[model samples]
Target: MIDNEPHKTKAYIAGVNLNDPNFDYYMTELANLTEANNMEVVGQSRQNTEQIVAGTYFGLGKINEIKSMAHGLKAKVLVLNDELSPVQIRNLEKLTKLRVIDRTELILEIFANRAKTKQAKLQVQLARLQYELPRLHPSENSLDQQRGNGGSTGGGFANRGAGESKLEMNRRTIDKQISAIKKELKKVANQEDIKSKRRNKKQIPKVALVGYTNAGKSTTMNGLLKEFTDESSDKEVFVKNMLFATLDTSVRRIDLNKNFSFILSDTVGFISKLPHNLVESFKATLQEAKDADLLINVVDASDPNMIQMIRTTQSVLREIGIKNIPMITAYNKADKTDRNYPQIEGNDILYSATDEKSIKLLAKLITKRVFANYKKFNLLLPLSDGKTLAYLHEHAQVMKESYENDGVHAEVRLAPENQERFKKYLV
Candidate 1:
């Protein structure tokens, strides 16, 4: 889909830190996330508290101060860098007199606005409902109690049929909507399952890209694909540098050349202290990560909290039961940083995908790492068999090839599945 840049809105952002070291990075990323969603940061406020205040997010005094500052600046919106409770949200709204949003709510609103596809829409709705389900207002919870008025048997809507109370009716409506979204998501999953099965049948390797929010996962995905595909064609390749840029999993068949096309999947990125409801809702979408044969864990080389981000990503990966998968850490954005080295231990590669040489290095490393798990084979094909020769050149690494009187003698290294295809051509 074509993307027209959005008009930016001026807003104020605040972070309440209980003396945490990562507070600065969190607030910084929060600002960027807001900007990505077309909000301009007019000002920022940070409050240090010995303990988190229960009533207001940043203690009563700091809340008043922020309110005064926002009022003076005429900020259109007030964004909290931390997660705010429902009561706190309501209280803050009353005090600040501006639209107050917590980080989770802000992220959900961004996802809701950015979702374009049917699967993406369903995913966002499921996530939003899940987030809302537990945060229902006290009055809303009372609606769940369907005890009829005046203790009469016909308490609710009083009808000949079994009518529900106002509260029960609301709950039923929400439940029905949730159920419908899940049902639609299941259909999309089934379709994806069929595609997954077909790839397995062909013995294609599945590689998934996972990282923290705004670590450039989607940008890297675009660079990887664009490296191989002719992007100048009428078909425009979608690449957004924004956080959660690619909400829905986009699986593309990448030609590793020499008869091998491995599947590359761009999955949702993980975040520090990600809300549980969002995680639970996105489980199906993240199943693509768990099922991956290899994981390309992307990291922002310029981020100060790179270590924390790494741990957060690992925490989620463990939660998903992906313990023993081989991973290649791709430290991205080397171009913008003073230095691009990460001290993390792993089979890793560091490069800005924007650089042509970096793209080549990444592609080469990908091919090398993926083929390491496969067996090698040698075969002889006739020179007249142009089709098989061309196939070999496209999908396999031809270590040795020679023109012969009878045919062509070729020794190749490839995945085992290609072994059978070359069997008939073997001398």
Candidate 2:
């Protein structure tokens, strides 16, 4: 028998730091991203500089040193900490004799590998193509043929002389693919919009969970779903202890009690220096957060770089055009820290998502923030007006109900909009 397991590439990570306070944290993230892409991080290097080198990312001497070190470590790939210019990537690869991959490309590769759904696959593909469009070179005119043949050359001298025309053809093909993907994405988004409108008609508030990748957003979602939702495997989203574990958005109606119900969504997690193209492509998936009434910004309280991670999430949210929405800073993973679990600070909470009591407290906090405008109302509907009564049952929190000779009497908690709509039947 022959063994046929694919070999993992050995990657050496490096970055040029311009005295950034978060330089080490960023390099750590680069290494993690490398591992997430199924590459083994065999070595690392960093250089402090006043500014990045324009032609080559690192100083010539630094590059030479990195080349020697990587050679010694048997590294086959050089992963940089920041997005590099096309010229820089080419120069570095020529000087070091190793494949050069920038931060943006690495992140995109991880996303491409992790995408499971058609929407996610299309989104990642769009971002990857956009990243490559600007980096195309005249010498790489065979790119279209290579991609068309599934990422491999046909092992012949065919089309060895074609130049400008081939590049133009490749560009046009990519442009056409981009347009087709956008059209398909629009169709999927329209379907989602219809469902969202249905949820909107129910008059329930929406809350979205967002945070740094692997900072426990999916775990938190599972915890809430397990405790509040009827036990069903399909109701739970996938939970894993890895970066970018959840790529698709998952929405579930969480009924906290007979008197409380709101829509909860778990969105794709954010990361520092996320590629702009990726964000643009994911806009449809992230619309849930954009339309949310409240956002729970989950943080890993146990991580030493928690503050930086929080800032990264906030920056990404702003880039995604989410502004002025109410948010609660949920410092999760309290069990990993020494602080008491389920502790509440103003506009923030320190809690473990896996704890039942902590989940209950989180639910209460969400209800308080999302339902702040709801008010109690006493109403009487005519016995024949069964439609209105049924509407109330579906949309409002019915505190009390009874049948009377004159009509059906009930006390309910209604949102501000609902309160006005049912004013005619008020007691």
Candidate 3:
């Protein structure tokens, strides 16, 4: 049967394996990324070589082979698994007669398209500018022509040749834009820091949802929101069956109970081989996870590549400098498999986000883990000291409070720090 779908850019993907065991998984992720970017992958190939060619990414014979195969499949673009230099990209474009896109460029394009908010847009722009700063050609016509033989040596704005002039002008423009964006981002980050300080003053136990993209982190967050938060149902973070459906960080207060109340944040998901520029640009957006008291690494239980996905998340977490923090491996989408609805195995849980009971169990597990060290304390504050009374509610879980002639008595559960700070009020 002749099948037909809407017009999409047909792309051919290829990679060179340098004897790495994870090469195949990288290619699989590349294909998924291509599809996520609204491109149809028509063919794929790999060359087993110990070293990469400096000029052209692939050997002469392999390039010709891939060119013929891509042409036969009517592919209009060639995608590679690794980032390519300007020289390699230009050389391959000349040899294959097809537009060439490296992994970094492809990921950046997707991020640029998905960005919606001002901060996310600025971050993607910053990363794109940094990526393009080094890859700019002297002119549209020629990839070479002595683009100033590297950086400035002694030339001033008064004198420059025509080609050098244009190249230098473009570089300066991008540099200025990069500096401006960084300034704006710093302002945004300062605002975020102020808000973070307020949350810290309250001493709420903060939990962050983090995992691989399209692994249902948002869905899990929505489940918790629907069950706990007072916000309208529509206030949930964006959810779609696609990679990077949401790029912004969302923090909401989850009051599961008076004792279990805490702050929950949903952050951008991770992917294997994520670009370093993108990571550096998004560090501020990912600040929630860094400050989290606990992390939930949601995994797709039904995916055949489950193990690889878990490993990828771990690798990305380490790359981002998150360590020594408590984490739970939540195996989501268990309903897709023939397993039970919800079950906990030590720090890991097999559950489905759509199931109400599963959400409750997961919440209970989190509550247990977050508050295990909390201890009950009895305190008596003078009736005139309303300030400490109010602080008690925010800093600790106040279980009971009563006013008498001389003072106010209260029962509360406090963390170690809170307990030490309030020891003077113990009765």
Cα deviation of 392 in candidate 1 (Å)? 17
Worst 10-residue lDDT window, candidate 1: 148-157
lDDT of 3 by residue, 278-309 (tens): 99999999999999999999999999888999
Q: Candidate 3: worst 10 consecutive residues by lDDT?
A: 140-149
Q: Is candidate 1 or candidate 2 better by lDDT?
A: 2
In candidate 1, what are the lDDT values of residues 1-427, reduced to their tens digit?
8778665676889988888988887887788778877788888899887877788877777878888888788787899887878888878888888888889888888888978888888888888887776565424343445543322334344441333344456666678889999999899889888987766655567888888877877777777677776652332235666777677787787775655557788877777666666677677778777888789999888877888888878998887678798899899888878864322334788888677778778877777778775656668787777887787876666767888787788777766767778777665
Off by over 4 Å in 1: 1-9, 138-165, 229-236, 338-346, 378-427
Of the candidates shown, which would achieve the greatest TM-score relative to the real structure? Answer: 3
Tens-place lDDT digits, model 2, residues 1-427: 7769678999999999999999999998999999999999999999998999999989999999999999999999999999999999999999999999999999999999999999999999999889988876645544755666433224334543454456677788788989999999899899999999899877678999999998888888888888888874688888888899999899998888877888899989988999999999999999999999999999999999999999999999999999999999999999999999898898889999889899989988998899888999999999998789889977887889999999999999997778878999999
Clashing pairs in 3: none
If scored against the real structure, what TM-score would every candidate get? Answer: 0.77, 0.91, 0.92
- Count of backbone collisions in candidate 2: 0
Regions of candidate 3 where Cα sits further than 4 Å from its true position: 1-6, 141-160, 384-394, 402-404
Model 2: weakest 10-residue lDDT segment is 149-158
